[model samples]
Target: MNMRRNDVNDLQVKVIPSTINPSSAELKCQSSCRLPDRSSFIWYKNGQKIQDETSSTYEGNFSPADSSSCALKGFEHHPAPSVCVHGQSCNRVIYTDRSICASRGSSVDISCTYSSDESITSSFWFSPDRSHQWQNPSQPEDLSKDSQYAGRVQLLETEKGRSTLRISDLRESDSAQYHFTFKTQSFEWRSSLPGTTLTVTALQVQVIPITVHQSHMEAELKCLSSCSPAGRISYVWFKNGQKMMKEETSLYSGQFNPGDNISCALKGHEDYRSPSVYAPKLPSVSVSPSAEIIEGSSVNLTCSSDANPAANYTWYKENEDSPKASGQIFTITDVRPEHSGNYYCEAQNKIGSHNSTLHLIVVTDPGTAITIAAGVTAAVLLLIIILSVFLWMRKKRASNQSSEAEERPDNRERTQPEQDNLHYASVQFSNNQADPLYSNIRSDQLHRHMEEQEVIEYAAVNFNRAGTAPRTRGQETGEDPSALYSTVNKTL
Candidate 1:
């Protein structure tokens, strides 16, 4: 008789007890049983009834009306007890679905479980917020719920005990809460947990940087992340996957403001160590734009060496020491022809150094003064030629005039009467030709004859031009013509 009472109590709580802990037992019973209306199921212990029993099964102190007892007559196991599961919202016979958003084109799962020990034969779902009721909705529903979830709603292929609903071809309209209804052999009830809600969102992607332009004076390197409610996050810089010692930028020309771009140096080991986070270490260097220089002019060189901590700059002359030229302009005020050579600048930092060479070719042309000198030389040579020609012609004319003057004789005049010769006889003969020194002749007559002959040969005076006359024609009858001519020639 006592044993029968224990057996009856065992039948009241139907779940099999786990051997691991006999005290802790699960309540497993039909999830769809109906109770006698107005007369609730009573829990009995030792042939006595208990009211409002909450335990799933009795492990110790069996007695009716004991709060520790797990016995209820005419009522199977149900999950509506107020002690709610952690992280869950409510503890009710039916729970509202909460898991909403899902990826597009993917299957959406709506999970539900009825908190009752009654055997669930079938389960159905209804589109909440839409005025529609389901009569055996698992089979077919009214046009309102049917038309809305028509091609997208269906029962899952799992066993009915799982009571899970899966909807395919989910669109944006299917994002509302759903109601799940459970059916058993004796009664029907909704799930204590609400149907799972689904919110389909577009597939989100990340924004990544590809390449940065070198010409940019200042630029940022960005690693775009999926747009989430959480704004911009922090970034970690890396070099060859090694985390950088520092995080901020100092040498960069631009600031790395929130969501803004970043810049870094690139003059190290000839390689780049990409950053781990979304932001990349933009290994960049500030390079001065190429400049123009006159062949003979000088200019100072300037360049920037890219680096994380920023690099120092050094000026050089073809890899030589930088001259003490102020500023970046290597000015040579009095630049000479020999002050020409190759020039360049170097920028350096703790990481490394960068250098570029610029060939300085000084330009020049012949000066105006030199050109003027050459022109003067040619003009003077031409003038000398003209003067030499003129002088030569003048000298030739003067020589001819002097020669004519020497060849011509001066004019002379002779005016006297002529006389007849007196008569005289004297004869002498010598057998031998006597020397003219021993011979004695008329001295005056001999001398006169010689003079006459000389005058006739030498005289050709321009008497017409001088206004004079011939002396020989003027001799008288008493004088010999030879003697008179001789005397006139000798006297003239």
Candidate 2:
């Protein structure tokens, strides 16, 4: 007698004889047996049942040549059993060991086994706590979550008789243990022990500096990734797939921040990017003493800017073949019509560049130009008018002095007597032309005129003594008897 252990509602016993002796097999009675609380028995031999069997232990016999044996089957079906085995109809008792799992940027496979050879029609996989139902056997082709598996999930079909589930796109979030279930004929699935904890990791390569100014001389870019405690992180920068030697970070001293952030600075690589660096705009330019140019004339031009890197100047001639000249002065030795056009200059540095334009035109020598001619004509006209006014003023002053002399009573009295005496002297001198006293005749008229007035008389005496007595007199004063006697007495 063999006792079968069961956890479900059923208790069973099987009797397999150690040796079969004859056509009829009989058994001696066992006095005591441990049976179920509520049990029934059935005895069968060669697909046939015995006619009567009531006692737990029986001694019965049979004839030979029948090829028969007696079998006793006791089943306690009041409560359901917990363990399902072959030829046993009870709830299944599934068991599996705990598991540990891990993966990288890809998928992971978790496996479980059963205790019995039960036929399974389907399978399912879920996360810890069974909150997330990952997959069902009927629909296993969906891979939207394939990214979570890192693109490398595969189910194992042939294994140690276990239902294994493979998950792809393993991320950090997929680090928990998973549960699995296998469906049997009754559409019932028993869960396996929670599988191993899957540790999903990845090697990341990210560009640190995301933005930069155009035509930046030098730009520093960093690439970093999350690494295992045992793994090392490496970085290299690529431009259009061509690696930059200066952009390498092998000698960098700093590591990624706790949250995986890093940065670097680039310098002195002016041509690293395209176009040009961003800088302040160029300053407006102007020229002083603006002139319409002529041959052999000089002009000055100035350049300025609002830039950080100080602006350099270069002159550009538009529609002309003149060689470029720097600085402010452009001396045109012999300017021609061809030298006339639009001219500009470029002021620039690493910061920025700007352009200013000026128009040049050809004309005659400014010294001898028509405009100068007009200015000279006006100046000459003004000088002539000033000279004419000056001469007119001088003549008017002479005329005014003559009129003033005629209008002054004191000086005019002396002038009228002098005039009358001059008339009388002229008559006397004309009458006595043949005599030596012709000069004395005019002086006698002045003496006769002076004798008529005391002031003139004194003046005559003084003038005769000084030998300057005017010949305008009618007669000599000394020839007068009265005057001669007075002079002699005075001399006495």
Candidate 3:
């Protein structure tokens, strides 16, 4: 009896955000009439039954574009209207979604609140796009009455001041800057202030290539609209045309098989999905030089794969426990006999992984090596002999130059004309001990020698003391003024 009554009515769902401005939520579905203990409930988003959501309670981050409702499991036919996901009811001309992206050929709702101090005489939405086309450009016209928007525009005043502008059969030409204007008796809210923008676009799935240090590499895909605003948008992803697990807001990030196809739709417009982007093709490995690798030469191994998201590359040698290298090009600077091996490169992305192998053989010839070594050794020996000989000759030349320099003075001495025979003369100093040379002061022998050598030179003396009349030097000496000293008679 309770089950029947509950079925006649409808299930009530409460949607609450975790914060005032929310990106996450908590939801509960309840039935007024008591049903069986085993009674189950299902979740619905935007009037569509959410796959695999059969719990009475829901906890997650949901798209702001979505509205949510709930239903009893067996009576899915009579669920109540979905309440908007947002709990925001802010005053003023605050738009619930400042930027809205909708699929072409679909419908979208842009909501805002316009309140005023004076009584609102008139309230409506206008597009700058249609205003430019009007005969009078200064005065904006209502979008619903415009011929271009005929039969496709709706204005619903949800409450006293809240309003929603719903546009159906969205076309790319319908993309425009939308504004809400409200007029009071004294003033009009001008369109100069920026308003909400609506973008009508077809969804596109794009692969965003990334280089992650992790070994278990996963490619990241992003859902994009052409010329879209730069921010995170909620999305629904599909793999092989099947809805991905629980329909996450973020696209799938994991390994995928070769035949698998990936596609995505904007979260609110899940019915209009983009074309599928396929996974990686078989990887191809190629070696540089296209000839046998030579000893002591560089070798390059390149790997490539065709995929929606470009593939990351890792290189491995056949017997190595760890990856030998990473990147599309793996280079061995100096290939040697020990480097000969079977190597392979694996190309991977979120979609899948594929690899191709290459064989390398480092060629070495023992006879050629020995011959080259012998030639190098012989050349080095010859160079050493030549250097030694050159150094020895240089040393001999230096010795000769030194000997010539030393003997040059002696040779000049032998070549010089003879000087006059030098006289043998000696000046004797007395042992008076107290300035004996000045006391006795006689050099007859030196005088005689000077006479014979005809080389006489003399020094002068000053006998005048301070404060005395300057004496003529010869006056005290009683000798020629040219004479340095005559005799010093001490107390005689």
Candidate 4:
């Protein structure tokens, strides 16, 4: 056993070993100060602290060419000086965390506490998995000096025998097992393999639908990363880019209204949140061929919108009460004038809905327009010609009827002279809007035809026997008082 009374601040400590040789042994401690519990006692070696090793006794071995010391927790500055005890080499390390998980692009702290039984000459951190490819290299290169870690690695010595390797802007390639190395005046510290393992991953948000309804949605969101989470990891959530309060967990279950955007991040790395998921945005519509569409030509309409959940599209015409088609694209087989109008598209999702700008569809008239117009003109001309022919035929028939009446034989016998003096005249009138002859007919035209069914009874002419009267056809035939018959009683 080795003991020393290197009193510092009148606080002395002694280490008692079960064996006096240079090998593993049981040791105990007694302090000159008031003895509290053993857990409050602090152990030291080679004028440096063995962090977290707080016991009145160190129940282990020592290096064959090294030394150790002890003190109370609060009296560490007054530690009892160390004594050389030959047992074995002094090269041991204890990490604050065996494994750590961090998000990519974020910083991380990989810390540890180490002890050596000899005076430390140099200390640095390294990664064995990324070391040089040479066979059995002496030791791995310092991480801070490596080109891959330049300007982003920070080597910190928080205190004697304690170190922290902070890496900024971490990447997946930086993931590996890290170790701490040190050199003494006589020998280099042998590293304990697998010092601290770092796992770098990108944050992602995954949604699983729990319940779906019309007004609202219930879903469970999980913040996921490739790195295996250790222990109780805390998580943070955001809604519409604003921080939201919830219990610390990787999974979140809640009701979301329409148009809500969600994201997540590790509690300590909230700056590196996952991408946001949301409903549809304002939609846009486009027409194929991009020029004027003609009748009978095929045209396609496409609707597009940005959304987390793929949006469904619907096409509708203005002033119409129904939707024309559904899907991202709407096709018209043969475009016609009926298909020409103002149209718009709707992009919808479970969360919300959006509409596109109105577009006017104009189906141009084809080359057949001139032919159709010519056909209509021909039909009108034929109708006019037929009306003119019908009027001519009616006029000829009326003239023939008058001639027959003149040729009809009278039933009563007439004196030969009276028959020669009798002369008769007949006329006919027609009702037609377009006939100029019908418009000029006089009202006293011997019981004119007033309707489709009318009878002209007779026409009688009276002859006066006065001397001063104008001469009639009968007077020219002979000097006698005769009857010029024109007495007609026409009944309708």
lDDT of each: 0.40, 0.44, 0.68, 0.67
Candidate 2 stretches greater than 4 Å from native: 1-104, 128-152, 201-492
Cα lDDT for residue 66, candidate 1: 17
Model 3 vs. true fold: TM:
0.35
Total backbone collisions for each predicted model: 48, 31, 2, 12
**For model 2, how does the per-residue alpha-carbon lDDT over 144-191 read when each residue is reduced to its tens digit?**
244454445566657544666676544567666554555566544332
Off by over 4 Å in 3: 1-106, 113-163, 168-177, 182-188, 197-258, 262-271, 274-279, 287-300, 306-311, 336-341, 349-352, 359-492
Q: Return the clash pairs for model 3, or none.
A: 219-350, 256-351
Tens-digit lDDT track of model 1 for 1-492: 112222322332343444676444443322133322333333332112334433333333221111111323433222222221221322223332344564334456676544434455765676544544555444433222476666766676464344456676555566666666555675554332224455754322122323343322223333322212122223334334344445532221222222232322222311222222122122232222233233343444444433433444444555456453323334555444554566555543322334555554344553543565678889999999999999999999999999878756431112111112222222222224231122223357744754554433222121122235323222313556455335534543
Task: Show where candidate 4 strays beyond 4 Å.
Answer: 1-101, 105-142, 146-199, 210-215, 296-298, 309-350, 357-492
The predicted structure with the larger lDDT, 2 or 3, is 3
How would the candidate models be sorted by TM-score, starting from the highest?
4, 3, 1, 2
lDDT of 3 by residue, 441-479 (tens): 337876565576565343323343445554443454676
Q: What order do candidates take by lDDT, descending? A: 3, 4, 2, 1
lDDT of model number 1: 0.40
Please give the distance, in angstroms, between residue 43's alpha carbon in candidate 2 and its true position after superposition: 37
Which scores greater on lDDT, model 3 or model 4? Answer: 3
Q: Between 1 and 3, whose TM-score is larger?
A: 3
- RMSD values for the candidates in order, in angstroms, are 34.0, 36.8, 20.3, 27.8
Candidate 3, position 146, lDDT: 87
